[model samples]
Target chain A: MIVSIEKCHHCGACVGSCPKNAIFLNDLVLVFSDECNRCGRCVKLCPVGAITMEAKK
Target chain B: MRKIEKDIVVVGAGPAGSMTAKHAAKKGARVLMIEKRQEIGSPVRCAEGISKHWVEEVGITVNNKWVAREVRGAKIKSPSGHTFLVDEKNAGNEVGWVVDRVLFDKALAADAARAGTEIMVKTSATSLIWENGKIAGVRAQTYGEPIEIRAKCVVGADGYESQVGRWAGIDTSLKADDIDTCYQYRLTGIDYDPDYCEFTLGSAAPGGYVWIFPKDEDTANVGIGVQLSKVKHPADPKMYLDKFIAKRPGLKKGQPLEAVAGAVSICAPLDSVSMDNLVLVGDAARMIDPITGGGISIGCIAGMCAGKVLAKGVKANDLSMNTLQEYETMWRDRLENKQWRNWMAKEKLTTLSDETLDKIVHTFSQYGVEKLSVQDLLAVIKRHHPELVKEFEELI
Candidate 1:
């Protein structure tokens, strides 16, 4: 998952909604860690559409 | 790395943190409040609406700088557009102020500072500092520099995304059904009644509702909350709110000035909020009203209770869970029953069909129910539509 710095409001919706507890908002930066299973709970719950799925290289 | 010592250390610096610090400091416990953000309140996330009664209860004077508009009443509409007005004079604290949350947060933090609490900005708590396998303080950082704060009491006043409680071995988990994913826009150039806050309920926002809180006659905070369980698409909350606004004649033409989003916990009150030297308050404690999804007033009240209890425990030199249990009992005695009642009602209400909502609202408009609340609605239903009362009685 990718968090868009420009669009994200940093409100913690995605951080709280992630079932795996894998998301964290470090000040202005929204961090998605490897603990995220791509269940996409954060994607649906993200208020600003800041998070999107990316092909894991 | 720097080391600091205080009688109390509060994390988050929001209303709950500041209130705890303010009251604890006032009672002579040294207090320090830390915020990860450089500014106390910005990039506003709340709907920014609150009842005024808690201000006086929390001993905060009404300050115009933070009050955007003093609403006189609330106008509720069902899916079919049937409207019911609940006037403040008659409804008591049902409707009050549409505030500037940024200014309000700053004011609370300032109040804490004035009460002799030390406040640090750009600091974040990384973990709990443990001693003898029990909580002692916080492992934190200022900007990028690590620091350890050793305190007798630690407060988890962090909001929805809080980790402080989890770090303390407190369970703060939520089911998807218990969370509300919200999106809002501060829209200007709309014709709005500055005196009345408005709400639209039913399938427009499944398992939740849309609200319009006027900042002024020409501007308003228009928002929608969709139950996380009901969201089936990416960005469903924003989509739902946009579609709702696009259909309203006056709202459709409004231009966006700001955007806000956050998750509101609409679950039952936690089983406990205190453990040993640690206690959680505000959203961390799940002090929000499940039906309204409003937290400011209730959270402030919880903060006041927390502040009093923690300070007393500190002064007694016993930070054990038994001592902290006083806080648990006090807050639960005052807030738990109501929170549970509302949670139960919300469960039943969310399962209701759009036609049921239209009918219920239509009846409310016709019968002229003096106030609108879960208890009041149930009472009215018992008096008039006795048969329908059973649908709600099963839970309450």
Candidate 2:
């Protein structure tokens, strides 16, 4: 999952929605950690539609 | 990184952070408040409704600058459209002012600045600075520049998903049921009663409610809060709100002026809000009202409590957990029991079926029970419908 900083409002909805607690907001930046398994919980939870999932390369 | 020092550092410039900074600075402590947003309250996420009494309790006067409208009461509409009105005097903190949140928040930050607190906008606390296993300061970035600030005490007023609390090893995680995903629109050209705020309950908003808080005779904030856990399928809150508005002719004709979206934590207060030299205030401590999802007043009060305790700790040269724990005890004494009761009430509300909700509203209206208390509601049920009273017996 990738969080576009420009679209993100820093509301922290995605942080609380991540089941693995992998998504965190440090200062104003939303960081997706290695613990994320591409679960799309945050993608749906984001209010501004800032989070998106990408296939692993 | 530019190094700065202060007696107290408060993260976030919302009501809680600004109030904490204001009180602490007034006590002869050097306070600095940091906000990540360029403007203090640019994006308004709330319904903008607050009780008048609490505003006064925080020593903030009610004025035309921020108050959009003064409401006389609140009307609760059940799923069946049966309504009951509760007067403002009896409603207590349930209803009062439909405010301009942008102005209100900016005013609060200005008040803090006037009280000798230095405020930095567009600054975000990236992480906490720990010394000997206690929080000593914060590492943050101002705009694009890095800055390190050290303080005797750190107050985390950083809203719902507080990273400061997370960094300090506080479990800020909430269950899906305890969080409300909300969407709101400031609408005009609506014929709504400006004197009262209206709340609609039941399946229309599963596990939560919808509200119409009027800013004027023709302008209002139309919003809905749906419990994330209660949403059985993948859905957007906006879709539900749109469907709801489409059903009402008056609202369907309304034009959207502004749109706001956010999530609110609607759970009981955290187990502990203070550890070592750090203390959490407002939404960081989960002090929001579980039933109404209102936090402004409670947050301000908690911030004042935190500011007082932190100032005393600095004066005593002790920023230990023991000293900061005073804030925990003080806020608990003032707000804990009420918050816990509200959470319990919210639990009971979520389990209610739509038919049951209609029956409850019908009962309240029939009995002319304008002022609602947990005990009164239970008594009304017991007198009119004995079977239903058993289900709510625990609440009383």
Candidate 3:
């Protein structure tokens, strides 16, 4: 998932809903690593709608 | 190894999945829906804003219990703070409502259940079952144990990252450039009319826009979206939102009640949504509207379409790639052209600088172009900014 620091609101919704714990409010934005399962729970739980699914073409 | 049988298996319990189950049940078909989440709509996404007309078109019953607020118009704010009120005359009759999405989604699922569709929560479909080159059923894990469910047909109503569709051998990947990153908040104790939704355009959000949808006189859902490809400075949306909120006299003092963030696809592909014994709906098929980032309406529509087509296939005792192709045609005929055009428009609009946007907003305001449809607005731009007009003309 693409976590844009500028677009994050630190809602914590994404952090709570990520099945694989791929998101966290490190500074302000939820940061994810290559370990993400791409389950999309974080993307769906976010009220502000900031995180997007990113996969290699 | 446990085996169960059903007429149809629907993966996911979002709007598309529920609607697919509902319509199939209405046709007297036995439908089973599996949702990975324990509760429907608990982890809320989306602004919960939808046009009233789409509900009416789908023959859904509207009630206050699920509606957060009703709106009759929209206001557009340029990056420089110039505002344009899209009067009711141009906003269309069904400007719509900001909904309690959790409630609305639950109600839709409830409606499907009441119509005889069986729902199983906390279950995930792990893979698709194929026999002799045709889909036969799905291998699912429910409550942490492996279980097999056989079905005549399977409907993939799963969202953007649809594993079921992927397992079914349908290509569902979205290009990084085709997606949007968005953020939203439910603010209470805000002072604003509950009758209008507000949109802020231009530099506030690159390649996207910001919206304030009122849930009540003191509460609203406000957020912003920007294209994934255009993040130059790459400022987090929250920082920009804070600045915007700090500047907005109406919202600066409002207390934020709840904050949520998520993503939605703008250019979801539908060409490969169907294959043998399986069809994809909603974000799995990438059926979202490219311009507005709205998918609930389109997802529901796709669900209903998939349901109808799947039912016909089952009744005819044929759920092959050929039969399911009917759904592909139907949805494409209905939405593909428009969505493709909207995607083009989105691309063109995203390329504009904030200054150009301000000029467009100013010119539109001066011409009272809020009264015109988006197509008409393009014509106005065509007249004055002919060079820019070419971009939009091609989109149309």
Q: Best by TM-score, which number?
A: 1
> How much is the lDDT of residue B325 in candidate 1?
87
* C-alpha DockQ of every model: 0.74, 0.37, 0.15
Task: Categorize the docking of model 2.
Answer: acceptable
Q: Give the clash total for candidate 1.
A: 0
iRMSD, all candidates: 1.2, 2.8, 7.2
* Model 1, span A1-57: residue lDDT tens: 887888788788877666677988776797778887898788878876778889878
- Candidate 2, B196-235: lDDT as tens digits: 9989999888888999999998999999988887755443
Summarize candidate 3's per-residue lDDT along B1-396 as a digit string, tens digits.
888899899998989999988988888788999997788876787888888767866657898999988888788888887777776677675377888988998999998899899999988887888888879888888888899989999988767656676677666555546766667678777777778888888878777889999898888988887665554433355556777788877788888777665566788455678877888888778788787888888888878888888888778888887788888887788778778877877777888888888878877777776444558778777777777687677644
- At residue B76, candidate 3 shows an lDDT of 82
Ranking by lDDT: 1, 2, 3
**Cα-based lDDT at residue B262, candidate 2:** 80
User: What is the Cα-based TM-score of model 1?
Assistant: 0.96
Name the top DockQ candidate. Answer: 1
Q: Each model's TM-score?
A: 0.96, 0.94, 0.86
Tens digits of lDDT, candidate 1, B1-396: 689999889999888888888888889888989998889987698888888666898978789999999999888899999997888745787678999989999999999999999999999999999999888999999988999999998999988888888888788888988999999999999977878889899999999999999899899999999998998887888989999988988989999998888899999999878898999999988788999999887788888888888789888998898788888888888889889999999988898888888877777777777556677777776777777678897653
Which ten residues in a row are the worst by lDDT in model 3 chain B? B230-239
Misplaced by over 4 Å in model 2 are A2-10, A19-21, A24-31, A47-57, B92-94
2 against 3, candidate with superior TM-score: 2
